[model samples]
Target: MNDSDAINKYHLSVERADGQTDNLVVSEGHQQPEDVASTRLERVNLRNGGNVDYQEFALEQEMILKARGASKILQVCVMLPLEGAYSMITPEGEECHFTPNQGFMFRYIGEEVTFTLPGHQTVRSLGFCVSLDVFKRYLDNQIPDTIKPMLQPKEIGSLPVPFQIDNFMRETLDRNLQVEAQGSLKQIRWEGTALLCMALVEEKLHKAANPETFSLTQACKQKAEAALELLMADMQDPPCLADLAQELSITEKKLNLIFKSLYGDTVFEYLRSIRLNKAKNLIEQTNMAMKEIAWTVGYNHSTNFSKAFTRQFNITPANFAKKARKLTKVS
Candidate 1:
């Protein structure tokens, strides 16, 4: 599909740091953003490049983003949600939740890719996109080859692929975020960052797709990180180890090893740490009751929840909430 078929794209008006305006269609295949009042954005900027467009923004809301009807254009998108998690319901009705450090790749095939943000946390997201025309030249070596599989146009409703955003990319994004370049210099810096990310992501995905005899590749660690997202997707009733292993096409023992080697914990222990961290945020930020917080984070009983919370943080949930509320009142 050509540019004409790529209608329904969102037009993000951009003003460079040097104070000039640009009207570029950065994201395609999704309709113009609707229900705008319900969402809030602190800042958003789009920068056009030779073959890629970089978009950076911070979002604070909890809403299901809508999509348009099916079309022919296939847009491969890379999104890194640095501070929060989002759920994407694929067009075929499969749902996947992507949390921080769990970057995702998907071919936006002219359908709705719903992203819902919970926990009422503010997250900064960095996104990069190359149009189909630009993406199709992998055989000609336009974009990095690692992205070829990810950029491959798929049938409608293909499953979203998850990847781990490693420490290098994280630190690179940090430095890129701090750059104060103006005009064309700004474009050079960010677009370079975009391609640099492309190389790293490609290498990571290549490892994940082709794992030899139980080796410890960055890609292996990346797949483990992806598993973490799926494991915690439904804290209430998550999939079992067998199921997760089947999804990754590895044995249960190997899956546990990946988690152990990369994260230094068994799956259960890692999950406990994550659950308690989420609960701590809830106690400090939201007004939800102890039982509600407990259940939300997968605890079945408040007594057990209080015990675990105290064990994790050295303070009971009730007292923690009370102290947090008191501090709120004081401030």
Candidate 2:
């Protein structure tokens, strides 16, 4: 079969699509009933003829990946929550919230996990799956001695603390997601990106003197999370920073710091990023007019929206929509 057909056949399988919203569901071990909301997925087979797979998914909603019914043998799950919050729940009931721009490393041999995403907004995430042998082979020389032991195949009670996704890391991952290649070249590109991402994760995790295990007080965590939800809910006209702080009964300075600490960006930066991503999705998934889409996303003028879209993605709204339509046809 051709490359596109091959990708469709092996790269992804959607159990069901929500007619109203674009959703591609993936469950643990490829089992039924587990839902993962994603609009795009690419599965790449290793070039060395290995059984390992390098996969990426762009999620659109919060989903629950059940652990009890999983069928596949998962060695390591390297996760990047590009745009939304995530909760990783262990079988023992230990749960932690992962903020945006944080990388999660999950070893799933002896442990069972249920991953849940936010239900309100779109969450773009990238995941890499590898066998235990494959993981050790690739990182044996690269990983430092101190962190090497953690890589050993074993189950633990708690999930490893997440690390920051710095500017350089963000650029690399974003570029990889936008890769446009065909056939063997596509596979090679994916493999290289996966290794690079893995290396980044290791480097960041190693440098962290103390990983954040979500030790924040339960009340504070819930309140801070509620603040995030409020901001995300209204993209066109979100609450002012001071108003948000007052609503949460916190100082503006403290609120800003909390957002920056949890997510790697300020409140303004995060909101702008979310808005641009929403615009991109609308361009790709809907046939709405530019003016209407702009207004819907909270941009008062089409020109302003186009300018922002161009600045963020380096593509004009019209051009992006045209290309998206073409790709939809080709796929």
Candidate 3:
């Protein structure tokens, strides 16, 4: 099969939020027998044989809704609340919420959940599911068998991990809901959306499992790399911390933090190291005098440069040049 076909076949199976919104409909139809307000849940199908959903629903009054009947499936879920204050109580008495700007994910199986939503509030939430097997694959099954069950908290003990929903995820969810692809492209679009969400879900799950893991987001990394490029471009006259941070639209303190995390050195120290390394290269590769080499690498005086070179490389600049010359002759 072609690549597109293979990808489509995977069919991300992006399930709607546990409670149907958009065009999704629950098994019991419009209102549960215990109904107090209007509700609509519909399972939408993509044209290319893939299933994706876009649901927007609301409770007309202040009332409790039983999420659904007990199920026999183990699943991982992700949800984002678009508007209003959404609240739910899991079967285990865990009172939970999904507010604006926050992402929520949890694991459960065949258990009922209750929505304790506010009155006259419309709930627009997007959620998707990843099977346990698929989730384990992404995590390399390193999840100890002992802790597998604990991945989803026991009844009354769901340790739901709350994280900030990044821009990429928010935009993707919005586009997936609004996108209307044509012909053969619809399934691929659906699958792509599903695949991206799965990746995001896996990443969040990894963080959830490893609480100590520090995620260096894309935005911060880009800024740090840009700063490095600027410093490398002109080692003889590197930018000062304040100026460099301003160019990168970051605080000087944040720039240093990024450098320390990525390179194990502060901005000043990193710049010094760069100058010393450049000086060593020029010393070995050129016939420049010690003072010239020092100037070339941003040091004002040969004595200062020699001190730093010795500290960094355990050899004086003159001695390094002599050793480099001897090596060239021997070769």
Candidate 4:
């Protein structure tokens, strides 16, 4: 759709090869009377009856958006706002706020909801809609019967922002939206991504439902935190997991469990993250040599450090430093 000075509004209709249509109405750069503005819409439909819709809205001033719609099919909606917080009011007057990384899951059954955004802010959201049968088939009866109630119509489920999954989801959506593709290839990509998204959500919900997977108590959390502090304080030459667990007065298995529960990473993975982050900062901010930086982060040799750094950040230390310096100079 072309941006036009005379056209105050644009309605774009996208027909997917899978026989789905997207009707989008976007603003023409000028703020609306309600002070809410939508820049554009990106939508993809899959052959499996799932669809992904993305929109970026900017608020020139504070306003409330009243959206009323009914669904002809039973579907699950997963929504994530990439920027700014917004309060949502359901038709029944139920209200909640959503932020970045945090998401809302609901089995939407034709209910209207209003979203309110503050002034001078932008909000980007990715929404996934999958028919009930498709969603259940993907789960393969893994979800417990107790949690099944959350899948009832109008029942909303809250997710605690699985960061790794969110990062992957956002990157996948952004890449697919930016790339120029048509028909079957685009539909295939969207289908694969939608499945992956559902897999991540299922894994998270499964973990939450399984008692053995998450049983960390307050005491266990404190012990895990203590272990983490020790790991960070002595990253150059940290103790092994067994010895650390010994120091914390917990069994190694318990140590591993609680650490993973509290920090979302294993003990060694946590150390690696700390090591890499410190190395990245040193590479960017300081004039430290590669070998020195490697040794500082507990890697005995620069090659191993380079491999780990590249595995984590997808950039070699030298290249990262070079780019950092170049960007710094330009700035």
Best by TM-score: 4
Candidate 3 Cα errors over 4 Å, as ranges: 1-40, 44-54, 58-60, 138-159, 182-187, 204-331
Q: Mind sharing the TM-score for model 4?
A: 0.53
Query: The CA-based lDDT of model 2 is what?
Result: 0.61
Candidate 4, residues 171-278, lDDT tens digits: the string is 565565566556777666667666766676665556556646657688988897798788878888888988998898888877877867777666787778889999
Tell how far residue 4 is off in model 1, in angstroms.
5.3
In model 4, the runs with Cα more than 4 Å from the true position are 1-38, 58-60, 141-143, 150-180, 211-331
Ranking by lDDT: 4, 2, 1, 3
Order of candidate numbers by TM-score, starting with the best = 4, 1, 2, 3
lDDT tens per residue, model 3, 1-331: 5432222221111122344332112431122222323444433333333233434545444545455422434555566654445676766777777664466666655455766555444555665544566556545777643235635543534446565554456556666756777656765665566567656655655644654324567888899889989988887788888999999898887777777678866787777788889888887788899899898888887777875675466455776788897887788
- After superposition, the stretches of candidate 2 with alpha carbons farther than 4 Å from their true spots are 1-38, 47-62, 67-74, 110-112, 153-159, 210-331
Clashes of 2: 1
lDDT per residue for candidate 2 within 1-331, as digits (tens), equals 4432232222222322243322233322221223444444434545532222323333444355443312234356577755545677866777766655566775554344666654444445666656556777778756555445546545453345567776568667777767887777776777787788888887787757544343345666666788879987887789998899899998776666666667756677667777888889988998899998898888999976875675466456787788898898899
Q: Candidate 4 has which clashing residue pairs, if any?
A: none
Residue lDDT tens for model 1, 202-242: 66677677653457888778778878899788998878878
